[model samples]
Target: MAIFNTRDRTIECRIVYYGPGRGGKTTNLEYIHRAFRKQTIGEMVSINTTGDRTLFFDFLPMGLGKIRGCEVKVQLYTVPGQIRYGSTRKLVLKGVDGVVFVADSLEVRRKENMLSLKDLQQNLAEQNKNIFKIPLVYQYNKRDLAEEGVPIMPVEVMERDLNSKLKIPSLPASAVNGKGVGATLKECLKLTLHHLQEELKWAVQDGL
Candidate 1:
């Protein structure tokens, strides 16, 4: 759920980048921070935990305009994808308004991607959130590896494996090179803000 500050006329929401370990979740954030300097509000904070790190930063999108007369402020975060960090991932996912699942494109990581997605579903369920209903996007990352002659899953296969049932928006990306990073985030933000608007409408109707 997004926090609406009636006094400040601003709404703050969280969007988490989630996927298997070394799946380029952090890379997406890093690229965004570097590429979208005008929108980035603060330093990208990282919390290191053994083999993985959790990162977050604030972003204020310009052209999306206000929601219900409140300026929208977004906080982007990346959950440590290592399986051992399940608790941390759940904590970060709390009160999430949207999600970007960064699925690795490497052929060897096919099962890992599936497992991470299942982990996400379970974690969201624990918070009384429905993965199916939530604003979510799939990013098939590391497409550049294919140019290096590395084994990578075809976009169609990745969709069938991870997104066939969800049928959400999915984009092929090379996060390290900033390819599709903006587009991925842009789509997620659009969906999230639209979802928030509907929620706010319902809340107002219910006299909340």
Candidate 2:
């Protein structure tokens, strides 16, 4: 399981980005790293391969203020998007606080997006994770594909098919242009903080 150290009044939270290969997961990170390198705290590490890059990487965000006297830190990650790396994906997903699914908006990749989502669900389930219960977001990436860049499937269609039951935050994005990346990250951060606050409250009430 991915472990975090909550010591010396510091809190570390893990957030994972999951999607099919070539879904611009790496692009999202590169954009953020370039745009906010000054504001970010730690190094962003990447391991690339042929089919899918990023076996796993850390987008260590700068301290997002503080909570209950603990320094709050958000670390972002992307697993290898190749389906063959299923075992590695699960290994990285362990102890995740939030999830962002980067979906390809091209018509040809529609089914791949659906299948990737299902794979994510199954991987999380193996770790006793219920997506419905955890913080989740959907980023429909590569919105600049077509002349109009219209989604292959309508947003509503994607919602009904992949996100209706969850009702989580979802947005259209062109990761190449740095659009919607910050918005997606911010929403995930807010949700994760809310959940962590509840957990911390429970710990305090229990006198832990």
Candidate 3:
């Protein structure tokens, strides 16, 4: 849900980074926070728990400047990827406007990736939202691991598994090293803005 602050002429949109445990969802946000330091509204807030993984969520707010006279503010969040944090994940996605599914490219995480995607769909359903209709992007992260002698899933395989039905653009990324991270985020923002535009147009038509 995008919130429009009429008095301030600003629009605030929430985008969530979601995936299985240790799949680089938080890394993506960290990279953006560091890379776009000037646009960052505040320090990135993170809470780690078991095994030093995210316990709740990571938040980073950004200012994207004015769009058609309305200042665009984006609140980025990453859900705790651990399976035990299912309820926490659902809470983080409460008013999400877009999502970047950061699927780990490690061959061993294939099953976990699938399960996380299913969980996202189920949670969205519980909110009365259609997963198919939501603005979403896929990121095949941890590609750099392959060079370290780690078995990584091929981009083709990842796409086949995660994007076959969603048909959204999927980008290969190595979030830790900043490769493809910006592009993945850019695509997500583009799709989200387009969705918001259509929504605004519909509202105007309804008022007419």
Best by TM-score: 3
> Which residue pairs come into collision in candidate 1?
none
Clashes of each: 0, 0, 0
lDDT against the true structure, each candidate: 0.84, 0.78, 0.90
Error in Å for residue 87 of model 1:
0.5
Residue by residue across 10-125, what tens digits does model 1's lDDT show?
77788999999899988898898888887777777776554555433223233233544566788888888888778878888999999999999999999999999999999999
lDDT of 3: 0.90
Error of 1 at 117 (Å): 0.4
Alpha-carbon deviation at 51 in model 1, angstroms:
5.6
Question: Candidate 2: where are CA atoms >4 Å away?
Answer: 1-7, 56-61, 67-69, 148-151, 202-208
Q: What TM-score, over all chains together, does every model reach?
A: 0.89, 0.86, 0.94
Model 3 spans with C-alpha error above 4 angstroms: 202-208
lDDT of 2: 0.78
Cα RMSDs of all predictions? 3.9, 3.5, 3.0
lDDT of 2 by residue, 51-164 (tens): 546665545566565555656677788888888788888888888988989998887888899999999889888889897888889998987876575547667777777887
- CA error at residue 121 for candidate 2, angstroms: 1.0
